[model samples]
Target: MFNGKFLTPCFKSKQPWKRLLSTQPSVVLAMSGGVDSSVSAALLKQQGYKVQGVYMRNWDSLDEVGHCTSKADWEDVQKVCSILDIECSQVDFVKEYWNNVFEKTLTDYAQGVTPNPDIGCNSFIKFGSLLDKIPEGTWFATGHYCRTNNGKLLRGLERNKDQSYYLSTVPEAALRRTLFPLGEIESKVKVKQLATDFGLLDIAKKKESMGICFVGQKRKFASFLQEYIDQPPGPVIDLDSGKVIGQHEGLYGYTIGQASRICHGSHKWFVADKLLDQNKLVCVAGSNHPALFSDTLVAKNWTWIHHQIPTLPVQVDAQVRYRQSPEKAILSQTPDGQYALRFTHPIRAIARGQQVVVWDQDWCLGGGVIDAVL
Candidate 1:
């Protein structure tokens, strides 16, 4: 139990700050100016804990187009901080992002795979990159809906909305210091109530951001690849004849499951494979391409949060993307410590650079950047 002052105002109001501060633990809130984070900040202040807002300024290349990371978000964050009566600081992570996170992701994507950047942002930037700035004994909290029990990360109360996949890469070292304030709450109605009750309704009804990912409404993967990964122009081949049917701008820019983008005379297409050796982009038209789906995925940059890789025949559930359902799998660990997941059912186009989050049921076992889909 916290030995600080009596929970006079805090216990009465059911604010987390009062609940957490009975032990006098200082807290730093990653305020994004959204209603959820705003409510978090407000509740923390009302409970009388030492609270401050730390907004991470990420790389959106806003100066180039003169937009994005919009002013509205900043203004909203400022308003919330004013209401909460706390100091706000902007932390720069652009350098670390490119050097520590982005560099490695692009390398994986060049070989033809789907990469999720939010994993890096969560594991490295939002958590790993900000440790030193927090005052001694202060714990770090974010607007994430997930929860952690005594430093053991767990799924959120809202199963449909869990972000554990992206957050699955957080190292154990950073996990010990992190807190998730929104872990136990339901989404939508409850979130609105929190906003309405706190007199932040104007912005409370606002839609939440997807995170620091730089994608746009359309598929930005092409542009992302063009900027970071080089794609030499190559021949688009007919799978049967292995003859050149058309041309593609770059072979590295395509994935196993994507077909509509390739201009193959509207015959319908399924990517069979990217043959860098043959310098050809292979596709099957209006038919099954069994080779595209793989029963196993070769995952590199393997990370085990709770413990090291389990012994052979390790039981784990693997997810290719945040929304994908969990798949039963066996992980084979290499002598060098890299691991590959062999799924019971073949997963479609298990791309090269996408992150693979393995779970031991509700507990996020850990994750890593997808190295290859073998």
Candidate 2:
């Protein structure tokens, strides 16, 4: 179920995209065997576009006893392609995923930041390596829930399912040639209904994927990180009283603003901050603890959709994570070219290494990694 989910902390784009579709342009569709991609492929083929399905075999082994769902997903991909009467091919990108996404993710975790691997997968793997497999001059399409307006990226029809945040890192060039057949669709339920109406019942019934992409949906993030990053127990300290309250599995095992597993009986504790150098997790008694909110945040690795960063102090709405409602903010460029977002209200747990995508109304202006909070 590889759509636009797994991502890493740092990424940059170099590809330039131009869309020169012929009367019957050939399209290489990333078919993840899910209903979204299946419906996308079917729709593209029906639209008189030459469509071919590409199933990426991304992760073969994950730490000796670990494996991914690529095998099962490939079976579904083949079935959909067969049903659609489109030629399907497989590409092995295990090495590419390991190098570009997984390694950076582990490094970010080690640095005490909860990074988005889905962003890295979209930037480096889907839009980067996969471009190499596609024949030159062919259009690349995906099932992502976003639209492009004359090369400018825009929100999908369904705001709840919009994926422009995960795709903020894709180079403008590649995006110019990208096709999102399901972009205008209103809802996931509607997409599934379309699939069933198109005779793709199995695809419509497939469960939507969650969590990490290559890793199974049920895999615990802490358990997964334990496999790569050392699982040293660290002290969980109360931020209010500066007292050692409990123990954490590891500093990297926690993310800011998330509920603490170290139960506080009747009271609740939320991770407020991580002291990486000291290997300590700071927890606050409540979810709305003052320590959990920040009005200002500094971000790095800025990548604009159209390669344009508006003048400093530009008013825009920003999102620290997917599915989060965009918050009004003043966007400015630090002297170092990093972005500074001063939200109208303090946001809860703006974690370093998470991408903060800025939007002008419905258009995604750009995105960057949160580097600091003020």
Quote the lDDT for 43 in model 1. 67
lDDT of 2 at 10: 11
lDDT score for residue 136 of model 2: 62
Instruction: TM-score for candidate 1, please give it.
Output: 0.83
Residue 34 deviation, candidate 1, in Å?
A: 2.8
Error of 1 at 31 (Å): 2.2
Q: For residues 254-331, what per-residue lDDT tens digits would candidate 1 score against the true structure?
A: 777777356666688777777776677888775456766788777777778875546676878889888888899987
124-153 per-residue lDDT for model 2 (tens digits): 988998875566668899999999987788
Candidate 2 off by > 4 Å: 1-23, 62-67
For model 2, the local distance difference test gives 0.83
Screening candidate 2 with a backbone cut-off below 3 angstroms (N, C-alpha, C), the clashing residue pairs are: 5-118, 6-117, 6-118, 7-116, 7-117, 7-118, 7-119, 7-120, 16-173, 17-173
